[model samples]
Target: MTPGTPGNHGPGPGDSSTMTTVESPRARVLPWLSTLARLVLGGVWIAAGVAKITDLDASVRAVRAYALLPEAVVQIVGPGLPPAEILLGALLVLGVGVRVGAVISTVLMAAFVVGIASAWIRGLSIDCGCFGSGGALAPGAEPTYGRELARDGGLLVLALFLVRWPAGRWALDAVLTRKDPT
Candidate 1:
């Protein structure tokens, strides 16, 4: 059989021209994993945002406690964060613009992680204000930077996964983009 002949045993491995690419099991499984990651991350953002939206002043105070930004910046960021979180979360939950949502989520989580770590390093005892109610901690109250960081880290991983594999079942992006799941 000739090397390039159809049905011929190729001289150097199978002929690439006639070969069909098969999806790996991992590849097949990724969409579901992405869906789970998207929903979980979205829910978290929604919960956090809802917790803070009720009291903008508390959110402001939480940002103020960090002392990482100028007062003007703090004023804007503190009130602005909750709505942003809610919007991002809703987008993820609805599977709309999932990659963009995940990217935004990753950025937000990274910022929180940095803020918490900085506060810990500076020995500033404060609530993370992640789910609202943030400010200086009471005297004798210990900071839970480790737990907060770990939680945010986990969420960041989820966000990264969603960013990489945004094509999930029931995703509006998939429908709008006309992506065939199979």
Candidate 2:
């Protein structure tokens, strides 16, 4: 038995276990940073989803402009993406299964990066339609591939951060974990 031992009452016999909850500065700060990441990523997803959902036909046209997929896949993905983005955004914002949400976000960002790069490389003058209608740019209007890629790249980083640190303040995960002893 020892002073640090668990279940000890002043003095105890056969007590060999101990518990500690001390956290380093980094540990304390990480959760808050993760919270920021979750909010930003979630907000982006929700905005993107809402924008596309409103004009599904335009969304489909945007996808078709990429010329990356067959018409069949484009038909399904164009319509389905908005809802999926909204759901993912909701989960992240709510702090429910954040790791899962972040992972999904990461994958989507990567796909978008690739798609954008492909379009740029192929010399297509298309609006990324990331936040809304994705189609061809106006006549003689330059595509802002560089800025678009940078934005998605930043979002991808946020997703990776959330995946690494899912726990955060003001999240359902924290509240639920607090209730569970384990």
Candidate 3:
């Protein structure tokens, strides 16, 4: 209450005592977040691909149940996609060609979101093929499209962040940078 003294604008709950209000450029946080996001999303994709690869038929059926694709397209896309997911996930997590992988992930997730929403809107009971056969129970039953949409929406946000910032920190790109003797 002392007019001569500075106001007490102390840290709030969940804040550490050591935390200081330092001004940082927006440019700095984005790449770090992008790297973290890439790894996190990549892990999910890896798990999904691995699970599906274990049960190809189940995955194929799940994709088919979506009723979003032609049978011929499903036959071709279903089997091959799992491996591609695995590869992309691995590349992303490993920080190899991470920007490219993030771009691919963003595109794929966007496509899935569209497909799942279309099925749900049309009142088709189908599997989302999200986490392979573990996405939703009962093939002929209407899956929890809202939940799946939310999850994919979250992932899409991360993907967009990656697309903007890229996995630049602690990555091969950083390692390859020329040393600057400032």
Candidate 4:
């Protein structure tokens, strides 16, 4: 078998073009999925943060309504949460330190889940205040604990997935790691 022959189609003296890279289907799909998850989670965080940051007092009141924390603690936490969430969201959206951001996201989500569950168990009819100022519901309004939990659960899964596979296409991490970014 000679060069260019069916069986002799190996790389030539100066040509590596004949050398092919074979990838499974999963390889082509996982990164796209990861990118989607990153964007979704990041966007959610940013929106939630923006909403609460606009009204610090309302944010404080929301935390106060939970009745799960001391007044002193709530004072600090209420004011601090918006900025922290915004930072985390920016990290995720920019794909910088993705795993760390995801881990933080997971922790936050877990805390939210516990808070919502606790409110439901304690017969508290307060709003979760996830996206905006959460506090007592209107007289005729009902709490949507179940729906909030489900949404948070889904976001938690997305964060977990990002933690497992932090690298994705168009991500800064990919450039920093110097992998086959495409």
The candidate that achieves the highest lDDT relative to the unseen native structure: 2
Instruction: Give per-residue CA lDDT, model 4, range 75-96, as digits (tens).
Output: 9988889889998898888888
Candidate 2 lDDT, 131-177, residue by residue in tens: 77568676778899999999999999999988877776567764444
CA shift at 164, candidate 4, in angstroms? 0.8
Query: What alpha-carbon RMSD in Å does predicted model 4 have with respect to the real structure?
Result: 9.2
Q: Which candidate model has the greater lDDT, 2 or 4?
A: 2
Candidate 1's C-alpha lDDT?
0.80
Predictions in order: lDDT: 0.80, 0.81, 0.71, 0.79
TM-score of 1: 0.83
Candidate 2 residue 166 C-alpha distance from true site, Å: 0.9
lDDT of 1 by residue, 1-182 (tens): 12123332222122111122454566445656877998899999999999999999999999999989999999999999999999998999888888889888889889989999999999887999889876756567788999999999999999988777776655666555543364
Question: Per lDDT, what order, best first?
Answer: 2, 1, 4, 3
lDDT score for residue 153 of model 4? 95
Give the clash count for model 1: 0
TM-score of each: 0.83, 0.84, 0.77, 0.83
Off by over 4 Å in 1: 1-21, 136-140, 179-182
Error at 133, model 2, angstroms: 2.1
Candidate 1 lDDT trough over 10 residues, lowest sum? 9-18
Superpose all Cα atoms of candidate 1 onto the true structure and report the RMSD in Å to 1 decimal.
10.1
